[model samples]
Target: MTRVMNAYYSNLIEGHNTRPRDIEAALAGRLDEVEDRPLAEEAAAHVRVQAWIDETSSRGDLPEPTSVAFICDLHRRFYDAMPEELRFTEHDGQRKEIIPGAFRAAGEEVSVGRHLPPSASRIPAFIDHFALRYRGLTSGPTGRILSIPAAHHRLNYIHPFLDGNGRVSRLMSHAMCQAAGIGGHGLWSISRGLARGLRDPAEYKEHMDAADQPRRGDRDGRGNLSLSTLTSFTGWFLTVMLDQIRFTEAMFDLNALQERYTRLIADLYPGKQRLPQLVAHVLRHGEMARGDARFVTGASERSARSDLGELISGGFLKSATPKGALRVAFPLDYRERLFPNLFTDAAPIVPAPPPPPPL
Candidate 1:
């Protein structure tokens, strides 16, 4: 669910307005032919790339986050899975094809607002400098975590790819967080933080632009870029990350979540008892064998099968096969009840305050 939300908001930054529910449907293999198919494909591709990053990071197999290979690979994996229409962008009034895993052609000048990305020819050397500077940070968690936003802004300034630079940068930030041991296992997303900050996308852009400025004065660091501005942005980025982590931790409190789960089961099936026990068992064990559902629910085999079928059909539980092990499924429809406020689109329901005494 967090990955799906990440995909939604990250693409939302690019002006692709795919809804959360639509992304959910796409993940379920239900594509809408008219309006959603394209956005759905794009969102699905983002999720896949994120999943790849997480897997690689967990195995300690990911390339240094700032390396040329990692950046190009992120671009390649995403675009290679994207549909043809999403792979091209206008450059110099002409539609240019984006080749997966390839850098922009030499002499290409891409404009991002007032900022002109470095000439494509300089990208490799710039990336080499990036890797050399940041690769050492990986040895320490504090350095690794602190470098995420700096790395994010630097990569965007380099603008190595023909397109999808923002998505790739965000994914690289996520990979860095994981490598730094702060990923929270996909329970929170910085993309949501970036999107929700100040309720304005332009603010995020302005921050990135500020970091792209040349060193302001003697007080600033000796680097070409404004270290002060970059530090400010990194501070904001770290705040966002911490806020997301704290928010998710509050939501995942086991007692509160179990209470909500019980209420949701009762609301979904008015007369069906013993469903909460079954859900609690799966939630505790992460998964349960089909034959064991009867034991957990304290119901006969026929009754257990019926309840399990109902839960699966309602998108609350999922199984590989009809009689296979079942795992809890927190699909988008149930997110509001199960994990409130996890997505920005679904505001948590709070009761209205009582009217104040008459003045």
Candidate 2:
């Protein structure tokens, strides 16, 4: 669920507003059902990249998040999965191909708004320095946690990729937080906070732009960039992260979850007194023997089977086989009701249409 939200908000921040419904469809191999195929493809690619990061991290085989090689891999994995039409960027009326895992060529010069990135030829050296400096800053967990925002900003400053630099930097920051032991196990997402901008989305971009300013005088840090401005950006970034953490924490609290879960069961299965307990059991235990539903609900086998079938058809429960263990399921159509405020789209959620026949 957080992965879907992350993909939605991250793509939204990049000006591609792929909704959670579309992302969910894409993940379920129903791409043909999604209305905006390109955007759905991008959202799907983002989720896949994050999944790779999580799996690699779990296996302890992840490359250093700050390393250029790891950064390029993030960009490569994301764009490589993108549709052909989305893999190119246009500048000054000219179109250029974005090499998935490669930095901009020597002659490819570019500017972002008012800030001119270093010439493409110099990106390699800048990236090397970036990795080294950050390695030193992140030698300890304390340093690692504190350096997240700075590293995020500095990576964007380097602008290593022809495009997709923003996405790559956000992914790197997420990995950094995970390595630092502050990732909340994917329970919370920084991209949501960054995209929300605490109120206006421009606030995020404004801070990034401010941090790009040159040294503001002797009082600023010794670097060519302004330390005071970077410090300000860091403070804002940390505040946003803390806010997201608190929001997710509150949403998942035991009492809060129980209340919401109860409400959802009641609303979805109104007047069905037995479903709440049965569903709650599956929710708590992860899965339950299908035959045991009769015992859990205090109903006869026939009635219990009927009740379970209803929940399964409603997308509230799932099973791999006719007699398989029943597991809790939160279908996209019911996500907003089950987890309010998780999505900002308030327009009535038309239940997702059925998928088209396979080609």
Candidate 3:
């Protein structure tokens, strides 16, 4: 559920409205004829890459978060799965193709909002400095968490890729959290917080743009950018991350989750008293063998099989194989009942508008 939610919000930030139900359908091998198929495919790609990042993090094999290879690999994996038509950016009536995993070519000049990224010829130097500065940080976990926002902004400021910079930067932030052991077992997402913060699109852009300004004065640190604004943005980002962690933790509280499941079972299968027990067993054990359902629910084997079938059909339980163990599954259709306020019906947030030309 968290992975799907992350993909939805990440795409939402890019102005793609691939709803959660549509994402779920795509994952289930049901493509939509009315909606653009490429968009759905892109969302699935985000989920796939995120899963890879999670696995890599778990194995402690993830590359340094700020490494050029890590950033480029993220771009490559995402666009590799996307349609060719969606892989280019146009500016000044000229189209520039985005080559997967390649840095922008020399002579390329890209502008993000009001700030211009350093010249393409200089990207390698900037990235080298970025990696050296960040990869060597000796901060503890709390300090590392606090450093994510500045690191995120700096990567965007560098703008290494020709396209998909935003998604790649966000993915890097997630990987950093995992590397620092702050990802909370993937229970929370910063993209959701960012998407929600951008609910007022202007404010979101304003905050991001604020960090792009050059050093305000001598006391603003010696870097080329404004350390104060960077610090402020970091605070905002961390607050959003902390809030999401708290919200997810509260939502997953054992008592509350049990109550929510009980109500859900009653609504989906009225008067099926043993269904909740089966759900509880799966939740407690992470997964349950098919034959163990009868023991857990105290129902006859035939009745247990019938109840399990209903649960699987309703999208509440998922089994790897037809007759294998069953684990909990949360379909987006029932997300509101099971996980309330997750997907809001609020207006879409637009991306940051281009900054006005300098005076």
lDDT of 1 by residue, 1-359 (tens): 77888998898888888877877777777776326787888998999889888878778787777777888888999998897788888989898999998888975779898889889998888888888888886678789888998899988998888888899999999888887888876666788778766345576787898888999898899988888888888877777677667666767777777788888999888978778888878887889998898888778999998888888888888988877889987766677788776665455443322221221
Model 1 segments more than 4 A misplaced: 27-29, 198-201, 294-297, 345-359
Residue pairs with backbone atoms closer than 3 Å in model 3 (clashes): none
Tens-digit per-residue lDDT, 187-302, candidate 3: 66788878877235345456789999999999998988998888878767776777667667766876777788877888777889888888877887799999999988788999
- Among all windows of 10 consecutive residues in model 3, the one with the lowest summed lDDT is 348-357
Candidate 1 to truth, TM: 0.90
lDDT of 2 by residue, 162-265 (tens): 99999999899888888888887777778988997766778889999999999989999998999988888988888788777777776666556556676788
Instruction: Decide which is better by TM-score, 2 or 3.
Output: 2
Q: Which residue pairs in candidate 1 collide?
A: none
TM-score for each candidate, following the candidate numbering: 0.90, 0.92, 0.90
| Runs in model 3 lying further than 4 Å from the true structure | 198-202, 345-359
lDDT of 3 at 56: 88
Ranking by lDDT: 2, 1, 3
Best by TM-score: 2
Worst 10 residues of 2 by lDDT: 350-359
- What's the true lDDT of residue 157 in model 2? 93
